[model samples]
Target chain A: MGMKCIGIDVGGTTVKVGLFETDGTLLDKWEVKSRKEEDGKYILPDVAASIREKLAGLGLDLKKDIVGAGLGVPGPVMPDGSVEVCVNLGWHHVNPQKELSGLLDGIPVKSGNDANVAALGEMWQGGGKGYSDIIMITLGTGVGGGVILDQKILSGRHGLGGEIGHIHVRDDEWEHCNCGGVGCLEQIASATGIAREARRKMAADSRDSMLRKFGDDVTAKDVLDAAKAGDELADEVFEVVARYLGLALGQAALIVDPEIFVIGGGVSRAGQFLVDRVFKYYDYFTPISKFKAKIGLATLGNDAGIYGAARLIL
Target chain B: MGMKCIGIDVGGTTVKVGLFETDGTLLDKWEVKSRKEEDGKYILPDVAASIREKLAGLGLDLKKDIVGAGLGVPGPVMPDGSVEVCVNLGWHHVNPQKELSGLLDGIPVKSGNDANVAALGEMWQGGGKGYSDIIMITLGTGVGGGVILDQKILSGRHGLGGEIGHIHVRDDEWEHCNCGGVGCLEQIASATGIAREARRKMAADSRDSMLRKFGDDVTAKDVLDAAKAGDELADEVFEVVARYLGLALGQAALIVDPEIFVIGGGVSRAGQFLVDRVFKYYDYFTPISKFKAKIGLATLGNDAGIYGAARLIL
Candidate 1:
């Protein structure tokens, strides 16, 4: 039997763990409850203990059979694997690598931001697979992205390099972002943003449509589904979301022209309908180039985070 | 004597060359006429001849004292040192590295986009000195920029990466950019753009001041100078330019998140007044972060291309 490594995705509620072969094949995976009290003290120790138990069940020893471990934390990860403040996890200036390595008796451990790890996973085995340089846009509750340049993650000086959600797309926006800025791409393009804009339109106009039936309880999925079902008002919201996303992506393209763009997250569930429309606007906004990048859907789903974490060491 | 290498900067009218030590010191520099005739056939040959002549005059031999050569072309460069179309030099699909290497008996040569090379030069010894990751914005006849991430130039798939100027900054702009886009950062922040805006405002409004004297010929410098000398109308124009440049740089900051930004090219001559004003708006636009990047002016001037070109091989 070949040696195996561990991959962990640490979220606010749960921690996902995976046992992966050196070549990135996931042999087994499971999730454990995340204990966030006491400044998240027990979280990492629990992760370590869980890994040890799993290895023992497989007749494996931590000394030789388990080579290393990689973690995806919901925070900004420094290049040296140190984490800097995850408000969601109540952590501050923590060295994930040192702590994990110490718990495993110097067995190497690597760490990265959850979004960045997901991107690496997509690039390695999912949508951006086979491409060395790629950009992954995860359109979940918020719009987040990660850039892989020259076959390596572009982690800049402050370790906030993949903060694509914060890129300002609207100058006329009066309201501030959750991060305290106006017209952020996230403000108009995120899942929450779509619902918010849909609600705004509903309040202003008494249009006869399906969204009006949902009133204030509409979700981004509901709007997208309504648009897919040929609802006029719902389609308008979708178009606005597509336009903002496409235009911002067009701008992002000029900055770091990758071979492909992998669209993921909850909003991406709309699939080809969303990609086709966004591609139209992306083409409209881009400079007439000899070649343009292809837009694709993320295939790995939630398992991408664990795969990418394992890749951090592999 | 320490072994040195050559750095060649190819432009439409002239080709500047320099001899640099491995430690990045400029040993000597000179220029030659750029012959764009005959589809740029004479360009590389002329460069090779010039190198031979310079080496002979210095009592040096290409096989010994000179290590290698680097070039900065006014075009996109493939990762492998192949060049795409260079309209300015009347070139189509030119492989500068192989051609120069063949001409000089395989002495080895490297190539890169002019803006990217200048960025590397600034990072090595200019305003971005002491920094490995940086973004260089050259506000000249048109705004052009290059990005350095993790100490390497972020050359995208088509070698058009770091084209920060082409990032769509305005949607209302009707006039087409040379790249066929509208409302690019180049259209507003360039030296030419500033003057063009001032001319448009002067023709439409009667609330004028010193700018009325220069009429259509007022330059970015003229506007900066007038603003410095207390001209209200010129100050208004300055505010617009600063607003656009500041806003664009702030957005770019969210992408690469470099350690520093080095402002160069013709319009950067506005000096601290320009940087200070841009910073005021950049700070206005950005969220308060624990770590923020600093902005500085490029010190290399025109020689940046050659110095940066030399750095490609180094």
Candidate 2:
């Protein structure tokens, strides 16, 4: 490879590592089991050591082979390269770039917020390939967004840019968001939001075809399956979710006006089921931005993080 | 001057023009009467001739002294510099930039949305000085916004970026907006919106001392004066307006997250009476962004458009 870099993705479950070329082509990929710790102070060193061992196993000398290392951790990374807070990982104000650089024997390291890294991944080699301005939204348990404006990841002054999940959609009715706001777009549109809404609608003595079959524990997937089978309640669930999401995206479109909105994560696996409904409601909400933009699904899957990280080296 | 440009502010009432140096220093300034017609084809040629005459009077050749001309029209400008649907100016699909350029003997002209240009003006020299990322809102009869991200003007794809006025504020129970949407930020928080709400409240029951004083005609300014005099109803109007405006700004902050929000236009002249009430309610709407950014009044007065247009030279 002309230029090589180490790409590391730290999640709550596992740590993914990849050896990638400057052009975002992955040479080899592997995952190491995360050493879960209640306290994050002890977790950073374990991650650093695991990456070093992986590089050694690949016969790649950290100091000679890699130009630098890029890490995407779950949470906000300060502009100065410190992980300010990771509620899930229980880390605060940890300088992962410095610690990782030291562990790798003075090799350079760069880090970003996880969603931002994912967006970069898409921009580099995934769904957002060849597009300079794109907005990536991951609809997992929570809705997270990453903004790439003019081909650069836009991290607001407080590292809070791309917080599309927190932007309000409803007026006075919505569940409290993880970020402590009510009526946030994420509260009614994410996977958790979709499941909660389905449960709420089903509990109101409302007659449903498929929901009545599945007793209490319902998931977003259940709604999708039922909708695919042409259940009224399941279709209604998707309509509600898409309506809120379309309104939020329309509002976001007024600000950034990205050429494309790439949807990712588990709920996005619903694919055209979710996208078609979103498009219908999108026209209803997107009066001003109708002629300006388009919406699409993210193409990259699990490896977007590594590809995006490697892209930073170029 | 290393680089100089002409800034022309075309409005329904008057035309303000200034020759500005690259450092945002005003070299010369003048104002001319405005002509509003159904199809005002003469406005551009007149403007261009006036500019040439003004430059000649100062012993400055238009071609040699000015690198380019920046025009700030009171509507959306096409990417090709043609204007579309200026409700205030009563023009539709007018190519003011091309017309002005033709009159200027083929000199290059750059144009932008009026609000966006106003923000560029502020960012270049006024209240938003030294800030690369800023959002400027003109709280006039309507609510208009200009967004600057990473030192470049964000006009979306079709020149509709800073349309902060059209974002949804309420789910229902507000006047319909011009965009055929219910509960737009403009429908509840603009001067026109405030006046309409005040009229409805006054019509409900005659308990307000301020309403009796104003009789049948109640404007946003009338409400402001009554609030200043401690009229309960007038104060209520201000409270409602401030509450909604703060909420809208907070929602906008979550998306753009600009370093500063500059408020201008006629209604914003209410000063602390407006800012204090807006800040009070802003916290309720924005929990995540409130800690990071601030909302302030626009420092540039009626000349904001001219200054904004002039700042393009800088």
Candidate 3:
């Protein structure tokens, strides 16, 4: 049998697992419910047991056929593979790499931040397929990002590399982000932020638009759908999002100067329409004629995390 | 004899050269006038002649005793060590690395941006000595920067990595930066920028300031000196500078998250006074309690470039 590696993406609700040929071809994939009780004590054990069962059913020897395992966690990870805290999974000081490796008959393991891993996945086989240096911006409920430099993750000294969402974008934001900072890019560019901006815009004016039909419960998807259908108010809200997102990406370009910026997550469902608008502002802010970083949409969808996780071990 | 390397810092007016041991000790240093009369055609050849003379004087063989040469140029250098344009030196499409290596009897040669090499020099033997990752901000005639990740220069795809000075920082500025961008950090934080801001502030109001004595001849040094002596107007000017500089550094921290930021150049002569003020704002912008990047002054002054250049070959 060909050498194999296991990719594990541990989220609050579920753990996505994938078995891949060492060369990155996905051979199988599955998921198991995450158990957060008793401080996530059962989560790792469950994942290990599931992997072992899968290996047995596939008639593969763990020590002989399996190369190693790669994990994606939802919090900052020290270079030593230990997590200080993962609030989503109620984990504290967990060494997933060591623990999972131990539970898997002494196989090796590597781990990284979830957002970072997703970016690696995209670079390996998605939007950033041909690029070695990229910044992946995930515009989900909260904005997340990852920086890949020369085909390696820029994990940073504090494990805070690619935390682009928290970069201050506006000085006028009155509210705080989940990270407790004011005027963060996440405040105006994430899915929640887009909906919030839409609500605020609708509340601030008597402008007639389709977003008004949803009132306070207006969703990001609804606003984006309306904007695509030529809703002026929705279009205006996206312009605001595009401005902040573009400005932040431009700033990132100045610092890291990645070859391309891969836009992923829920808001990215708007696709090239959103990308073009953001690129306009990114270009304006950067304006370096020969050094502009390309902007593109991520293509791996939910499976990017698994792909990136596997890439860590490979 | 021990293996040796030559470090050359090519500038607009002069070239600073240093002979170094392979382990980075500065054995001897000298300078040569840069001849820019012919598109800087003689600059590298002149530097090569000077190095060979020094090596002969010291009784060292060119190919047997000298390891290589490293060059720090005044413009963006491609990964291949070729420059598209270096206006200060009147150079275009100059491959300094190949040219210097050829002139120096085929010893290896590496080249990098001047600011980047200075940062590497600082990291090798200056303020960032112990840190493998750093962002060096040079606050001179123009704000300049270099990013070192894992002890190597992050020379971006477009050679724009660590070009933090051009990062957009403000929106209210009416004047365009030298780079043709509006509200760049260099507009408020460089030595020239500080003097300009002081002049604008003095003109805006009859503010009682020691800086008023300088009239139209006010300098960044005058402003900093006055601030050191408790001039309120000067203090306000620095507050603005600190705010923008800190904000830019914070933005950089979010992307590369280096272990420390090394502040260098003319304006950095204010020393820890300027560093403390900028750190205050950097901390405010990047309020991540556990992941703060330290700020410090660059210790190596003019010789940092040569030291870093030699480090390239080593």
lDDT of 2 by residue, B1-314 (tens): 46688888888888888888867777778887676775665667678888888877878887887887888988777767887777767778878777777889888877788788888888777788888889888888888889887676787766778888887667756556888777777877778887887887788867847666666678888888888899888788788888778876676676667788788888888987787788777677677643566677888776677777766544
- How far out, in Å, is residue B144 in model 2? 0.5
**What's the CA error at residue A105 for candidate 3, in Å?**
1.0
Question: Residue-wise lDDT of candidate 3 within B2-106, one digit each (tens)?
Answer: 888888999999999999988878899999999999899999899988988988899989889888888999999888888999999999988989998889878
Q: How much is B306 displaced in model 2, in angstroms?
A: 2.2
DockQ for all candidate structures vs. native? 0.67, 0.59, 0.82
Which ranges in model 1 have alpha carbons more than 4 Å from their true place?
none
Candidate 1 per-residue lDDT over residues A135-191, each given as its tens digit: 788998888788777666766667666677877788767888877878888988889
**lDDT value for model 1:** 0.86
lDDT of each: 0.86, 0.78, 0.92
Docking class of 3: high
Ranking by DockQ: 3, 1, 2
By the lDDT metric, which is better: model 1 or model 2? Answer: 1
> In terms of DockQ, which candidate is strongest?
3
Best by lDDT: 3
Candidate 1 CAPRI assessment class? medium
Any runs in candidate 3 off by more than 4 Å, and if so which? Answer: none
B194-231, model 1: which lDDT tens digit per residue? 99888977887799689899987888888989999999
